[model samples]
Target: MVEHGKGHPDRLAQGEQAITEVAADRLDEDGRHEGRLVLTPDRIYFLDNEHSSGGHDDVIDHTRFQGAEVTGDDTVGTLALNWSDQGKVYEGNTLELRTFKDAIDDQLNP
Candidate 1:
């Protein structure tokens, strides 16, 4: 898992800036997979190291981001991202999830 506050700015497109990122367990119908959740100016995406082929495993444009829900406490938990018609859940440290949610909210409202 990605350490708290660590980010992958190099993964961004040219001129794209990263707000924050974290290492989390992506919970899918298939199972949980280790990946990094990245927040950029234009989108939030997951980079699944186990299956990556030089592209995001999944992406949600900022325009499609509805909101986020954090379940758990200060030590550990899950982060649920609400999108246009669906949502995604990621399990990680509570502090990192909260920070990521706050960053997304700030961008949406800023």
Candidate 2:
């Protein structure tokens, strides 16, 4: 579950994980704004700007969504940056965002 200050907890589905209350500063190298995100066990999720709840007030000039991937297995996994603007929902145990995007593109183009 992910939650912010004084806000209700956002529930995650079974077999899913969430990175809640992510400060925007954590999103980038420099600490500039407040930003939060929720990552399911499979995919990373970006909340709507409104849902950012004034957390990302300083994160201007950014895209609506960015791509991400998870490496490793059930014992442990690392999240890494992948693609940008690739509309795919995460399910589980996939660490190559570009590969997923390619598959999606091929399916759409073919």
Which one is best on TM-score? 1
lDDT by residue (20-106, candidate 2, tens digit) is: 333221334432232334433343334433434534332211233354454556533333444453232223223333333343334
> What TM-score, over all chains together, does every model reach?
0.83, 0.26
Tens digits of per-residue lDDT, candidate 1, 1-110, equal 34323455555566666667888888989899888888877988787878646453778888888889999977889999888989889999998888888888887889
What TM-score does candidate 2 get on C-alpha atoms?
Answer: 0.26
Off by over 4 Å in 2: 1-15, 19-21, 25-35, 49-80, 84-110
Q: How many backbone clashes does candidate 2 have?
A: 7
What C-alpha lDDT do the candidate models reach, one value each?
A: 0.79, 0.35
The alpha-carbon deviation from the true structure for residue 106 of candidate 1, after best TM-score superposition, in angstroms, is: 1.0
